[model samples]
Target: MKNRILSIDVLRGITICLMIVVNTPGSWSYVYAPLKHSEWHGCTPTDLVFPSFLFVVGLSMSISLKKLNRDNHRKIRNKLLKRGAVIFLIGLLLNWFPFYQTNIADLRIFGVLQRIALAFMLAGIVITLIQNTRSLILSLIALLLTHWSLLYFLGGTTPYDLESNISGTIDIWLLGSNHVYSGFGIPFDPEGLLGTLSSAAQVILGYLIGKNTLKHGKPGTKELNHLAVVSLSLIAVSLVWNFVYPINKPLWTGSYTLYTSGIITGFWAILIWVIDIGKKEKWTLPFKVFGQNPLASYVLSIIVVKLFIYVFKINGTTLYGWSFKHLFQRIFENHLASFMYALAFTFIIWLFAFWLYKKGKVIKI
Candidate 1:
């Protein structure tokens, strides 16, 4: 039990680390290919980061929600609502942070943390209602298929087209173009309402895996073999489905969910093998710290970056740009310099995380 939990913490920490690195490049234009999200279709390492965090969220839920019983339903419901709302509100505030710089009415309505909050709440409710593994599996299947059908049937000829897809259309209609993400050169949000269906399914998959791990007792060689088989099966099925539906991150396609969850599950299995079975845990401290306080670390990193970009200035340039150009860009090629800046920034956050760990602080939110 101890080793299994440690592996989860490490997985979460790794995800948070990569998220900070990818999101804090010196210049978006100069980022390496792997760190950048795919143009539209297909997935990248960066694309997997967010879903991996959600997968961890689900895995954590499996442990936390295990205490749920009929008598505690009301208490759990209130707890879920309160936590979900708080997380969603924080994401919203982050979107509009440095309030003077943001137009109040035009802020993006959905984002990474918001998606996590929603998926967590939805998955919690589903898990509570369906304790049976078979029923939960069926629920997961229904979510994926329902999302796919909506996109293909409701979307016109070009179902997966960036501009015309059903998801984007719905987002624009409901949230208004001004309030939706314009990153895709359209009023589309990757974390929009329609995508939540698949996102919830992703969480349920993680929960199911975690529940299975608990049911089978402590992870060992036999458990590792089972995870490998399941992970490979998910990967194979997703690859085949990719030909038809295409694995898209922005759309949060079913194939993308399956592919990412499979990859993360396989990684988790490796962690258990190394940290538990082999007892090779000497290098796990940093990740364990990160895992212990992920929410605080992630939120702090974003707030600090926002301050650098929006509030601080150096010789007529934002502090972020000035530091990147003067310190990093001057030392190396554009892409490498950009990457170096991200690495340094990630290190700063890691230091903060380490301090919190040393002080025995684990920010629960």
Candidate 2:
């Protein structure tokens, strides 16, 4: 408990809150531009949400994997494997929820949680194997470069093309067209397997930051200055890389990974300065509640939304539709109404999270 970082928890909570808002808009058709993910290339506020969550996942791992060493590495690896498997299973189950929406054979095989699971497990194992920070940095660079090489060399003329990108090609080859996501007007899963290379890099970056933070006890002015320099450097390099590689969130490009990781690190550094140092903890209560049980809160939000969309109805309209039509849409513009519904939905989930926090419960995944 002494080593627990409030800033990390608050950051996790912020990410989850935004994840719900962007994900469950009253109508996907009416989302604001910032709320929508970039169609193919470039980054958006929505694009940052998932990667930010993954970055936080990496930070948490810094603490969790600190005990790994030659003596107990085997046991630790097995435990990480189990945890990652369970998380992946949860993501799979989420995709297959209600079981009637899609044919079992054609169900999506990868999603946000699946990506998180893979990134965490893969990054955890890498960190375990390479305990030294210098080696971990080398591994992170290698992961990014390798992902870039594979996509550039094998992805045809338009390497980062949505339809022709090597990442999607790999997904289709491994998971089959029917088993992949078809949202991009093609069977391409953005959270596909190949993207995990860079995703793991994102986690490793977080781990490196966390490891450094823990090593120094708690962050201070010196740590903040160092973090700011490193974060800005990553952003600068990513921007330069974008000229050639392009910053594609769907592709989960190496540039995108670096950009998001840098942005998240800077943001976390600010949080540490404000919350951890300035002692401003009162406003963080709601987010702390959300952060403490992030996985459970996220899963519950998904299920609750599903119930509204898939099960409950009002006068022949799905509950989600009915509520949006009556509660918010009737008063506000379509876009604002859509956003309002998402906000209200998030608040509902927050209530559930707050109750858990009040009960002194943390539902570990």
Question: How many collisions per candidate?
Answer: 0, 0
Supply candidate 1's per-residue lDDT for 261: 92
Cα lDDT computed for each candidate against the true fold: 0.90, 0.91
Q: In candidate 1, which residue ranges exceed 4 Å CA deviation?
A: 1-4
Model 1 residue 168 lDDT score: 90
Best by lDDT: 2
Task: State the lDDT of candidate 2 residue by residue for 1-365, as single tens digits.
Answer: 67679999999999999999998999988999999999999999899999999899888888877777888887887888799999999999999887788688988999999999999889888987888899999999999999999999998999999878888888888979999999989889999999999999999999898888766677888888888998999999999999999999988999999999889989998999999889899999989989999999999998998889888988889999999989898999999999999999999999999999999899976
* TM-score of each model, in listed order: 0.97, 0.98
RMSD for each model, in Å, please?
1.4, 1.0
Clashing pairs in 1: none
